[model samples]
Target: MKNTEQFIGKRVLVVGLAKSGMAAAGLLHRLGAEVIVNDARPLEGNEEAATLQALGIEVIGGGHPSDLLERGFDIIVKNPGIPYSNSLITQALERGLRIWTEVELAGLISEASIIAITGSNGKTTTTTLLYHMLNIGKKKPLIAGNIGTVACTVAEKAKNDEVMVLEASSFQLAGTENFKPHIAIFTNLYDAHLDYHGSTTEYLDAKLQVARNQTAEDFLIYNNDQEIVRSSVETMHAQKIPFSTEGKVVEGISADEEWIYWLGEPFISTKEIKLPGRHNLENILAATAAAILTGCKKTAIENVLSSFTGVRHRMQFVREFNGRTIYNDSKATNTLATKSAISSFKQPVILIAGGLERGHSFEELRPHMNNIRTVVAIGETAERFTEFAKSCGVEQSLLATTMEDAVKVAYESSSEDDVILLSPSCASWDQYPSFEIRGDQFIHAVMKL
Candidate 1:
């Protein structure tokens, strides 16, 4: 913990009653800060608000009041998912309220050294792998941030000897001010969350913030292959360590077809890893860099890399039924992700894709169409995906109303030794609450077969 006394008697507002907001409110309240929690969900059936109220924290349910910002709170701990376009956030910015994401709050109080990972993709896998590496090294590491548990909640109990591995997002980083991680990993960059950030420049700016507060004493391990990623931090003062799958790097981590090279020394072999895709290769490189810098042994890194299957919903193997290998990649909620997943397999793939249309085109994925044997389009963007698939020379492109139907169609059409992959190139909001649920349904449907 940095200084708990700084928050004593300070007025703070915690906005949005999701996991992050609730955790922030409780942490601040316990730290002697006067905390007020608010959410748009109505008072009825609001279990989150009820819990905060029980903690003696003031709770405002039903809606975000227009005058809530005028209450003279000294600080605002906002849920990153709450868009800048939201009225509450707009008002707070207008009133010059010091806004912080729970990550920022965590950084202020955490005695544990933080290792934050951020990118458009591969953040969860890299963060999880780093945590596993630290565990193998006998370091007590806390896994928090965008994956599940709030960073602040985890930091509340974090010990000085422990390490906090966080899966940071642009949303979270966008609200951050002085959130500096001891070791920061920027996996790779792609244009994403344009709907929320409104433009590529704004989105990149948020992602770059992970390195802003870092100094020469701190470390930043980033992708050397991504031009945009490399250019973003040209002027950064932090000790830069580059990880590349594209070519060998003299001072950092690099990967050849056979092995990963750490500072020109042979590290781990790629053949031992189970996760598919070149994107996963990039993830391994970034994780390996961070792990080595944090004192993890090569044996520990290899042990996890070989044994670790993969994170769920991100090219997770479902089952083999009727000679076809089924894979659930519902986390591929963008064209780039779908393209990478498709590129991973040499075997013909019966791809089940499409979801809520977020104004992104399927054009980028067109080049990988040759690898796709069949297409099963589902959700709001089904027609768009189907049409695009046909235009890209896919022999058979079918539309399904449900995930079950998509699975069945893919199974029936797929041949022996083929892969039936559920790599939806859009979000799950049109039919399911999240990509996890969409993936679960895909797994269940595969099990039934």
Candidate 2:
């Protein structure tokens, strides 16, 4: 761990009182920094602010006062979700104050070996799988980052012998300067979060930061199949180990029609995997390669490959009612994700799609519409999805007023041999706060049938 004395008598400001913000404030205080927290949300009934105040940390709530920038804070720890476009962040940058995310702070203090995962999709699934794989191999893995647990909290509680598997996002990766992972895994990149990063180039640049600080001793397990992913890390300093679903990669992991191969040897059969989708097969291959690099037993890797069903909300199977299989892929917040979800099944799909538009179109989803028997549209993009579906040669499309109606319509439209899939090609911000809630509502509606 780095010296806490460097923080002693230093002035620090924590922006946004979310999970990462709270943990960072407490850590700074414990390290002897004079910490002040600024959150745009109102202070009344704000438990996080109250807790910080109780610890003698000054809390400014409701707004980010412009005068706060002149307070001579030595550093600012901003939550990753709070965009760089935020005024306070811009002001901090202009004033030349060192800005960081909690992940950067975690890297400084953590004694445990860190294995970080980042991508446009499959971050949570691959991170969870690797955590489980390490556990079965008795590696004592602790999971954190975008999957929910605060990194600073995990770093403080982590043991030296333990390994930390972090599910990092582009938001989290953008704020780091010196943060580096011992083992960094890049699951394929896609067109995502363009709203925040402003462009595809910036988004990919942020994702590459996961391997930024690694050395020759560290490992970078990545998907060579993704041209963007492969190109970004071409000159990386870490030992590169590639995973691919598109034929053989010398001295790396690859998969064919029926089997996953590792280092020129058959590792696991595709038939043993419970998770649906070729995309998930990609996720599994990435996780397996990382696990093998970390010395996880082949038996443990096979067990997870064969038995781990999947993470919730990402192509998760809900139920089988009357002969139709229902899948809740509410995490498919982009067209690429929805396309992958729809292409997973061999049977005809009754696709339930539509949600908040993130400047992404359903045009990419059109090519896969041949497998979609019908589409039940909902939320803000319903009409847009319907038009896209029709243009793609889909003969049947229905617009539902509610999620329950969408589920009902899908089930009613599906035959015994068909699949009812809830893979929204857009985000849930229009109706639900998160994809988890959207997925839960879908499951609830399916249960009532």
Candidate 3:
């Protein structure tokens, strides 16, 4: 594989005008390339369009052009938000144009090795933990991907032998070609992103595509606890290393006797990790596999793992008022992750559940409602979830008209020592742009009380 500087002075078609797209367009324009950026929005009132205009980049509303595929591109920089099956992108590929995602573009210019993590859950926690460990090492590791900076932005700062840790989402990986990592990690996968993928198999396939382009020389660290991830990752080209709650590994990691174990030179058991929940223990396993593979000492991982406060919104302890502790777990956008969040609690929980439903059946989580004291549902999925809660014999459930009202009801309903958790098993698209916004709103509501 050779590095082609073909993009220099070449006419580049930048598709998608989000942050990544604007960044790509700006970068290309600065590099002496003719940059044309496109997006589906019909007008320029949003931040994306404003950024494009500010950059003096010609922006087009609505999808790709028909002439793009026929003429082909010197290079196509795609935003990770777009799907791989997009017709215009596919058509451009058929014409032999080099199509690279923001992540792929970032990897090309990154002078450092990459540590990429992907999963339906815990990616943010694991990514943040890895960064914390690097900080404890006193090294600067660029933490980017789905959570922070897009890959293309990082690629421009490539320095030799530097380590770039990325949180690659399935959306990012779907369009990534030649996006190799020195070490790639797969956390557990569950039913998620089905709206974009249309089915579980397709969603899993899109995720495993991270390893699909890798060679045996590369290293893959994954969770053995995930049957779907283990089965979907058929890439034997890379070294298959599993981190598990059970099973032994020649070069894998697992927990036994309440200690994290590894198979490497400084093979030692982690004694006291500070991250919350057993789900985080699984996250620690995935992180340890990546750390060990990258030659990070077991002692170092343990040291940071003890001090890690955990990622925000994944079982985040919001506040303690009137003997009831509130936790904002707005990031639990799927039923399985919500199930894990609920399981993390011992005291009876007053769960504030509901939001934009992704068409997931609540049957799996229904069986575990015995621990729920009273479920105060709100948002779009309130009716659907409240119905499910009742069907599961949830005696005390109410569908609130708004999030603030829901929070009020939940706090009023719970006794001292009971946990009030905002663990919506669906996205927040109905009322908010992101889970962070929804979580912040919940926090504001609670504070006002």
lDDT of 2: 0.89
Q: For candidate 1, write residues 1-449 as lDDT tens digits.
A: 66889899999998887888888888888889999988888888989888888878888888999888777899998889899999888888888889888998889999999999999889998988888888998888899998868999889889999999999999999989999999999988787789999999999899989999999999999989989999998888899999998788988899988888888888778888877788888888888888888898889988888877678998887777878988889999888889999999999999999999887788999888998989999999999899999999998999999988988898999899999999999999999999999999999999988
lDDT of 2 by residue, 1-449 (tens): 55557789999999998789999999999999999999998999999999999999999999989788888888899988898889999888888879899998889889899999998788989998999999999999999998868998899888889999999888988989998899999998877778899999999999999998999999999888988788889889999999988997767899988888988788788888888888888889889988888899989998888788778998888888999988989998888888899889888999999999766667887678898989999999899889888889886999998899999898888798899999998999999999999999999999999
What C-alpha lDDT values do all the predictions have?
0.89, 0.89, 0.78
Q: What lDDT does candidate 3 reach at residue 152?
A: 67
C-alpha lDDT (0 to 100) for residue 71 of candidate 1: 79
For candidate 3, write residues 315-364 as lDDT tens digits.
Answer: 77777899998888988888887888888778899999999866878887
- In candidate 1, stretches whose alpha carbon ends up further than 4 angstroms from where it belongs are 321-323, 357-360
Against the hidden reference, what TM-scores do the models get? Answer: 0.94, 0.95, 0.88
Cand. 1 TM to true fold: 0.94
As a TM-score, model 3 comes out at: 0.88
The runs of at least 3 residues in candidate 3 whose Cα sits more than 4 Å from the true structure, single-residue gaps closed, are 1-4, 42-58, 84-87, 198-201, 213-217, 247-250, 264-271, 297-299, 357-360
Clash number for model 2? 0
Considering summed lDDT, which 10 consecutive residues are worst modelled in model 3?
264-273
C-alpha lDDT of candidate 3 relative to the true structure: 0.78
Worst 10 residues of 2 by lDDT: 357-366
